[model samples]
Target: MISSTTMGLLVLLALSIPVGIVLFLLGFGIDAFFSPFPLIRGLGNLVWSTSNNATLIAIPFFVLLGEVLVRSGVAARTYAALDRWVSWLPGGLVHANVATATMFSATSGSSVATAATVATVAMPQAERLGYDPKLFSGAIAAGGTLGIMIPPSINLIVYGFLTQSSIPKLFLAGLLPGLGLALGFMVIVAIICLLRPDLGGERRMFPFVQMMRALLALVPIILLFTVIIGSIYKGWATPTEAASVGVFGALLIGAVFGTMNLSVLHESLLGTIKITSMIMLVVIGASFLNFTLASANLGGALEGLLDSMNLTPFGLILVVVGIYIVLGFFIETLSLMVVTIPIIVPLVVAQGYDPIWFGILMIVLIEMALITPPVGLNLYVVQGARKTGRMGDVMLGVIPFVLVMLGMVALLIAFPQIALYLPETID
Candidate 1:
């Protein structure tokens, strides 16, 4: 049954069918060939249960927040502000891309939306400046993955909802690791540019007063982040409710900046609906597939396999991480999380490892998944923005970031405190 499912997934993906449709096809195949029961009969229930979720509602809300920022000119201004601060680095505008993404990741929840926003603003600058597209666009895609790592992250909320862990703890756990990766990204850029001076553009330092003035532009985002994350930690709102707070905060910021207009609002709404619908389709399909796979005793197979190995806890973790990296290349991020968390998290926790730490570890791999080829949403998004570059450029661009992500994963493995220390201290 497992073999059949694997073959079906590979074939469907190779045919270039839409991911959502491929998931549905796999569910049907599983029900037909793998299970004794009528798993297909559960499809409607799975779809309804998945879509009716308040937790899943965070998806649209977070995506809406990003749409508002992009439409209101906040994203561009944020990019410009970061440029004033970080363009003095060897990577020039690429540093701004990472810095701007780190800032926005504090507020936005979706990597695709973050990449779209940054790419829209930063892509034009890359072309005008004649920087290497591979490194430039790659930085945007990698930086955008921070959307899932930083606070107010929809992915963390989803993980919490799925695993029944505390959302605030997961948010806290991700903070250091996220920022560490961001700094690591910049360092990599600097080192690469230092080695080959032509890859990056000229580094321009802003005057002290101008840098101070540009700092004001960041106030709105900082306020929005505080409101959203603050509401969650303060117990003023649940994780899902915090998403609403973020949406409202983004709207208020847009109005304050005077970028709010009927036309902008209309575009925001339309773009929100399109992206929400696209994500929901895949999510709903994945939910149905998960249901079928569970009925087919796939979970039992995984449990048995793990038991048969008789490995140490650390060895078990390495195996789990290996599984995620392999599966990450083929699966969409949300679907990958949904399918594996139920099966893997329990085994890891049973080994006496921290769930919060493992969640952060999983996120690092998920971030890598965002930029990997043939299936990475971030790669597609950055490519979609290019309008001229081959898909290969975006793929090539993310290679360095992928290595950075692997280093992060290793760091988390060696020092779980990177993910746990803050959560441990937090009340």
Candidate 2:
């Protein structure tokens, strides 16, 4: 059955079908070929349950927040500000890409939105400056993955909602690791540029007064992050409610910045609808497929496989990590999490591993998945932003970051506290 599903996915995806459609086709195949039950009957229920979710409502809200920021000129200002601060680094504006993405990650919940925001504002600069498209675009795609790792992340909220973990704790657990990955990305860029000077743009230093002025440009994003995350930790609102707070905060900031107008708002709303609808289609399809897969004894097969291994706790973790990396290559990040977490998380917890730690671990793997080939959403996003470059450049650019992610995985394995320390101390 597993073999059959794998072949089906390959054949359908090779035909260049849309990922959401491919998932539906695979679900139907699973129901008809592998399962004994009439799993297709559950499709309507799964679609309704997935879309009607209050928690999932955060998806649209976060995407809208990013849209407002980008359409309002805030994202461009923030990118320019970061460029002033980090352009002196060895990698020049590429460092700014990582920095801006990190900042936006604090405010926005969606990685695609973060990538789109950064790419929209930064891509023009890459062309103007004669920077390598691979690293420039790769930085945006890889850095945008921070959206899921930072506090107030929609992906973490979704993981919590699905796994029955505390959202606040998940948020806390992500803080340190998120920052660490940003730093790691910078370090890798520096090393790469240091080895081959031609890969990066010339490092430029800004005056002290100009740098201070740039600092002021960050105020709007800082305030928005505080409002959204503070509301959650202060018990003033649930994660969903905080998303509403974020939307209002974005609008107010845009208006105050004098970038808000009827046309801007309309475009923002339309962009939000298009992205939200795209994501929801995949999400809804994934949920229905999950229902059918679960009913078809896929979970039982996974359990039997794990049980047969009879490995130690650490060994079991490595297996899980391996599983996510392999699956990550083929599945969308959210769908990958939805389809596997039900079967995998329970097994990891049974091995005496911390759920929060595992969640962060899974996120790092998922972040890698975002950049990996064949089905990586980030790859497609970065490619879409480019007018002429081949997709392979973006894929090649992410290779170093993928290595960084591997090291991060090993670090988390060596010291579980990397993920658990902040959450444990906070509450």
Candidate 3:
């Protein structure tokens, strides 16, 4: 089953079958060859159960919220504002690339959107200013992965929904790790640029007065983040409920800033529909694949395989991280999470790992997936925004940040509290 499933996935994905369709097709093959109880008969019920989920409703709302922020110009303002504050660092606007991504991640829960948003704004500047394209574009791609790590993240919502964990607690778990990654990216850039000064552009400190004025541009996103995340953390709203609240807050922000309009709303809703539909297809397909796998006892087979290895807890985590990094090179992050969470999370929990901590750990790994070669969405996003650079440059650029992510995975291993502390205290 493992060999057949693996080959089928690789062949189908290589042939350009949509990731979601590949999942459904794989499930059908498994049902035909492995399951004795006619798992295919249950497909309709599984589809309904997965699609009807209230937690899933949050996906569209979050996408809509992000769309509104982008269309309303709030995202652009936030980017410009962060540039003023961080461009004085050793890497100059490379710091802004990461900073902008981090700030926008709080507003946009989709990593691709965050990367695309930042890349669109930052790419032209890299050319104009003569910054090293490798690190400059790489920072945007790597930093954009924060979209899944920060509060109000779509990935966390999906994780919570799939694992039956608390979405708000998951949000809390991600806060420190996400911010830490943002800071760590900046630190890595600073060290690199300090060692090789030509890689970075002019690092000029903006006047304090000008910095203060630029600060106002960030206020809208911060306020929107507070309303959405605060509502959930304070027990005033459920995660799904909070998503709607976030939409209202975003619309209000745009209206106050004079960026909201009939045209903006039309575009935002259209973009929201497109993104949400794509995510749901992968999610639903993964659901069916998971159902078929469980019905055929593949989960048990995988768990037994792990047990046979006699690995320690730390060893198991290391193995999982390794699996994600390799698979990330080929799989879309969302599809990877959905299909694996059902199969993998159970085994890890049986080994006594905290689900919440593992979720954050998985996210760190998923962030790597976004920047890694072949299927890395952020790599494509940043590359697409560029007019002339070789795609290899962006790929080469993300190497250091990938090492930094591997370091973060190690940190989470040595000290799990980076994810646990906020959640434990918040409740």
Candidate 4:
């Protein structure tokens, strides 16, 4: 059953079928071939159950908030402002790409949104400044992965929903690791540029006064992040409520910055509808697929396979990491999470691992997947923004960042405190 299901998934995905449709097809296949029970009858309840949730409501709110911010021109200003602070580094404007993506990730929630916003703003600068296209574009693609690792993350929300864990706790757990990944990206870029100076564009230092002024542009973003994350930490709002607050805060910031107008609002709303619809469709389809898989005892089979290996906890973790890395190559990140969490989380928990820590670890892998080849959404996003570069340039550029992500995975496995510390402190 597992073998057949995997083959079906790869074939359908390779055929350019929508991920949601592929999931539905897989669910029907399982129901017909593997499940003795009539799992098809529960499709209505599964769809309703998946869609009717306050937690899931946070997804659209956060997405709209990102859309509003993107359309309002703040993102471009923020990118320029960040360039002033970080462009003096060995990698010049490349550092700014990572920095700006990290900043936006705090609020954008969606990795694709974060990547698109940063790529749109930063790509023009890469061309104008004669920066190396591979490293320059690669930085934006890798840095954008922070969106799902930072607070107010749509992926983290989905992880929490599917795992029945606390969304706020997951948010807290992700904070340090996400920031660490951003810092690691810069460090790696600096080291690489230091070795190959030509790859880095001209490093320019700003006057003290101008650098100070750039701080003003960043204030609104920082305050907006503070308001959303602060509310959740203070126990004043659920993740959903914090997301709505973020939307209002984004609009207010836009208005104050004189960037808000009806046109921007209309674009934000339309973009929100398109993105949210896509997410919900994939989510609902995954829910049905998970239901059918459960009915077919697929989870049990996987557990038995793992248990039969007689692996130690550390060995089990390595196996899980390997699984995600391989699957990450082909699966859309969210769909991967929804389909595997039910089966994987329980197995990891049985091995005495914390689900929250595993979630963070999983996110790091997902982040790597975002920059990985062929199907990596962020690579395509960055490449599309370039409008001229060979796709291979973006793919080759992300190689170093992918290695850094692997290092992050090892760190998390060896010392889970990297993920648990922040969450443990808050409560």
Candidate 5:
């Protein structure tokens, strides 16, 4: 049954069917052929219960927060400001791309939004400055993935919801590793540019006073991140409520920056609706599929199969990581998470791994998925923002950063405390 299900998923996806539809079809197939009891009768209730969560409200709110920053031109200013601060590095403005994405990721929960926001603002600079499109665009694509691993992350929220884990703890768990990954990206860029000076564009250092002044442009985003994350950590608000606060803060900041108007708000709303609808559809479909899979006892079969392997707990985790890497190349990040969380999380937990730590580790892998080939959403997003460039450039550019991500995965496995320290310290 597992082998057949895997084959069906690949076949449907290869046929170019939408991921949401594929999940629904898989659920119906399992109900008809695999389950002893009827699963179709409960579909409506399952979807309602899945979508009715208040925590999920954070999705649209965070999307709007990113949209507001992008439409109001604040994102551009922030990118330029970071350019003043980090362009002196070996990779020049590419460092700014990664820095801007890291800053934006603190507030923007969606990796796609983070990537789009950075690409929209930074692509023009790359063309004008004569930077290699491959490395510059690759930095944006790879850096934007920090969105999921950073706090106020939509992916972490979804993982928490599906696993019944504490969302705030998950957020805390992701913080250290996320920031570490961003720093790792910057270091890799520096090393590469140092080795091949031509790949890096001109390195320009702003005056010290000017660099200090550029810090002002970053204030709004930092404050917004602090408010959203602080509220949750301080026990003053839930994640959903904090997301509402983030939207209001973003709007107020937009107004203070003299960029807020009805047009911006209107566009932000439309973007939010489009993104939120897409996410909810995938979530709803996955919920039904998970219900059907559980009814079919797919979890039992998977667990029994693993138990028969007689592997160490660490070996089991390595296998899980391998599964995600392989599945990630074909599946969209959200679809991948929603589909596998039910089956995989329980098995890992049974081996005595912490879910919060595992959640952070999963996100690191998902970050790689965002930049990987064919199905990597971030790669396409960065490529689309380019006025002239082959998609292959973006693909080739991400190779080094993907290796950085793999090292991050190994670090997380070898030293679980990287993800756990913040949460444990706070508790």
Candidate 6:
């Protein structure tokens, strides 16, 4: 069953099957070939159970919030505002790309959205300013991964809903590590650009007064993040409720900027429906597949296999990380989580790891996947934003940030508190 499932999955994916469809097909395969009972009969119940989840409602709300911000011109303004402060760093505008991505990630809850936003704003500047395309583009891609690691993250909501963990706690767990990763991105970029100054654009320090004025442009996003996360942390709202608050806040911000219109709202709703449907399909398919796996006792078989190996805890984590890195090469990030978390997370939890910490760890791996080659979504997004650069330049650019992510993985392993501190200390 294991061999067939793994092999069939790869074959289906290679044939260009949609990931959600591939999961459903795999589930049917498992039931037909492996299960003695008719597992297909249980499909209706499984779909209903997955679709009826109230916690899952956060997905659309967060996706809508990102859409509103993107459509209302908030992201471009935030990027330009941040450039004034961070462009004076060794990496110049490259630091702005990272800083803007980090800030936008806090508001957006989507790595793809954040990457796309920054790439659109920063790519033209890179060309006009004579910046090396690789690092400048790479910084936006890598920095954008913070969207899943920060509070109000759509991915964390999905993780919590699937794992039956606390979404608020997962949000808290990701805070320190998310900021740390952002800082690490900036430091790494600065070091590289300091050594090869030509790679960064011209370092221009804005006057303090002008920088302060640029600060005003960031208030909308900052307040939106605060409203979303603060309500949750203060025990006044659930994550889903906070997402609604965010949508309202986004609308108000749009009005303040005088960009709110029927068209933007229409676009936001349509985008929300499209993204939400895609996510829900994968989620529902994973649910059915998981149900079949449970019926077939794959968990017990997996445990037995692990016991036969007699692997230590750390060794097991290394194996899990290795699995994510390998899988990251081909699978989409959301699909990857929905497909594996049901199986892999349970195994990790059974080994005495905290589910919240592991969620953050998984997110780091997801972030790495976003910037890794072959199927790295951010690489393509950044490259598409550029009218002239070779795709290889974007690929080559992400190498250092990938190294920084590897270091982050090791740091999390060495000092798990980086992800755990806020969650444990707060509520």
lDDT of 4 by residue, 1-427 (tens): 7888888998999999999999999999999999899888989988998999889999999999999999999899999889889989999999999999999999899899999999999888888899999999999999999999999899999999999998999999999999999999999999999999999989999998999999999999999999999999999998899999999999998999898999999999999999999999999999999999998999999988988999999999999999989998998888888888988999999989999999999999988888886689999999889999699999999999999999999999889999999889877
Query: Which of 2 and 3 is the better model by lDDT?
Result: 3
All candidates: TM-score: 0.94, 0.93, 0.98, 0.99, 0.99, 0.98
Clashes counted in candidate 4 amount to: 0
How good is model 1 by TM-score? 0.94
Candidate 3 local distance difference test against the native: 0.90
Residue 375: error of model 5 in Å? 0.4
Q: What does candidate 2's lDDT look like per residue over 171-223, in tens digits?
A: 88888899999999999999999998778888889999999999999988998
- In model 5, the Cα lDDT at residue 199 comes to 93
Residue-pair clashes per candidate, as listed? 0, 0, 0, 0, 0, 0
Residues 178-219 of candidate 5: C-alpha lDDT, one tens digit per residue? 899899999999999999989999999789999899899999
Per-candidate Cα lDDT values, in order, are: 0.87, 0.86, 0.90, 0.93, 0.92, 0.89
lDDT of 1 by residue, 122-171 (tens): 99899999999999999999999999999878789878877888888999
For model 3, the superposed segments whose C-alpha errors exceed 4 Å read none
Task: For each candidate in turn, give its C-alpha RMSD to the true structure in angstroms.
Answer: 1.9, 2.1, 1.0, 0.8, 0.9, 1.1
Q: Compare candidates 1 and 6 on TM-score and give the better one.
A: 6
The per-residue C-alpha lDDT of model 5 at residue 119 equals: 95
**Superposition TM-score, candidate 5 onto the true structure:** 0.99
Please provide, for model 3 over 1-427, each residue's C-alpha lDDT reduced to its tens digit, 9 standing for 90 to 100. Answer: 7768878888999999999999999999999999997888888888899999888998999999999988888878887888889888899999988888888898789998999888888888888899999999899999889999998799998899899998889999999999999999999999999999999999878899989999898887888788888888889998888889889989999999998999999999999998998898998899899888888898888888889999998899889988998889998899889988998898889889999999999999999999988999998888889968799999999999999998999999899999999899876
lDDT of 4 at 325: 93
lDDT of 1: 0.87
User: For candidate 6, lDDT tens digit of each residue in 1-427?
Assistant: 6667778888898899988999999999889987899999988888998899899988898999999999999988998899999888898999999888888888789898889888998888988899988898889899888888987798998899889999999999998888889999999998998899888879998889999999999988888888888899988999989998999999999999999899999999999899889889999998888888888888778778887999898888999999999989988898789878878888898889999999999999999999887878888988889978699998899999999899999999999988888888775
Report the Cα lDDT for residue 324, model 4.
Answer: 88
